[model samples]
Target: METINARSWVERFIKTVVDQAGELTELDRRAGDGDYGTNLRSALRRVEANLAGVASDAPDAVFTAVSDGFLNTGGTSGPLFGMWFREFTRSPELTTAALAEAAAGGVAVVQRLGKAEVGHKTMVDAMVPAAEALTAAAGRDEPLAEAVRAAASAAHTGAASTESLLAKRGRASYVGENARGVVDPGALTVALFFDAAS
Candidate 1:
């Protein structure tokens, strides 16, 4: 019943990332340079700017703005996260299935861009599972709220499960077995997005 307009969705997303920035930075510190939080926050600001002339009712337009902002912002996350928003825009509407489809598209983009697949200790590992869970929930006739909640839970579980996976993508890939016990920052960040939407 809590259908958010584009502006509200954008604000919620910004707040989610900002609130979780420290956590994301900590995760990155384990294997990366600890810039995921900074990158995402900066990108969100750009997204806000891009939305200045756009209508909040147009979720697709908002999505496009997000993708463009991320792409222009520059960073590994730029392409990785950008693909997710771009994929969301490809959907017909901002329905539960559309969100799932966007998550799927994100995973696919990460695979193609990073040359990493499932079980590779990347965001795709978490996102792919979350997307499947959302899709399954939709198939079961769950309400949009319930479906998003399920997806957020799945994303969290998937991110936690990453602690057991060896590094095979991004900076973590260089860490090999050392990355096994740490959750991926990017994966955790994506989970936060699900939490925001839910």
Candidate 2:
């Protein structure tokens, strides 16, 4: 089987999101602003389309396309996605280690921007774990694709574990005790991206 490239990863992300938007939206409605899924879906389609012309071999190009597309689309998610791609752009080499580093950098930027940390029940919950998993896999000299898959799996587990956390950021934070036991919308969104990229 052929390993998926950056372009393929973006395509899969778009499709996965477009397919799961409604389900995610319903999940978000309970504890969030109820528009998380819709916001992601709309931004993803534009990013996906912008990426079609980018070369699969050009990881930086792909990241730039994602950043530009998301920024153009405009939303809280747009800037978040742009930050992620900006981190990705900092590395020119496309390797398992590079990908892991980029993911970690992206998580750092999000943490800085959102002023949230681990246990906040935000996307950082999933992203930080995913980046760690990827780094471990890279240290073990795993294939790039396999490392990404491991990271994605870890991200999903992190998202699920958010059910026990209290929201400390975003609209859900206002709910306080009522936010406990609810998985964060942003965490789920991160899981979706990792799943597709993997």
Candidate 3:
């Protein structure tokens, strides 16, 4: 199958996040400040609202609009995700391998900004594994849809793994051991992205 275009990917992600906003917020309440869902929903709404003015056939333009929308929103996730999508614009194409590298690039920016690692119980936990899975799938010559399916599966596993981890970053870190048994909302949000891609 062909790779999904930028507009379709963004629209699907916004729809998925909107549909799961309450669940995401509840997850955050268990271990975080309980605003992740709202923050993401608000950011995505902005992206959706601005999408109409962008070139429907231009992936770079669409991604830029999405980045701008997220960056304009108020939230840690907004800026981080905005940076993530912004990296996509640097790629000349959106093939599976290029997408994987773009995702890795985004993870690097998030890590640099957040000072968090894969085991830090942050979105990096899911994002790192998803990038790896995407890269591996690309190496195996998988189609874009199949590669993203692998990424989504890996992200889901990574998000679930956070349930057993002590928070080492973000507000949950303040909770220490008490953060265990609750999945990281950021990780779940990353999982949702790949899930929507699939």
Identify the candidate with maximal lDDT. 3
The runs of at least 3 residues in candidate 2 whose Cα sits more than 4 Å from the true structure, single-residue gaps closed, are 53-57
Query: What lDDT, from 0 to 1, does candidate 1 have?
Result: 0.77
> Candidate 1's residue-wise lDDT over 100-172, tens digit each?
6777777777778888777777787778878998889868867777887888888888888788988777888
> Which 10-residue window in model 3 sums to the lowest lDDT?
54-63
User: RMSD (Cα, Å) of candidate 3?
Assistant: 1.4
- The predictions' CA RMSDs to the true structure, in order, are 1.8, 1.9, 1.4
Q: Which residue segments of model 1 deviate by more than 4 Å?
A: none
Worst 10 residues of 2 by lDDT: 69-78
Query: By descending lDDT, how would the candidates be arranged?
Result: 3, 2, 1
lDDT of 2 by residue, 21-72 (tens): 8877876787777887877777777787777766655778887888777776
lDDT of 3: 0.85
Candidate number of the best TM-score: 3
The segments of candidate 3 whose C-alpha lies over 4 angstroms from its true place after superposition are: none
Residue clash pairs of candidate 1: none
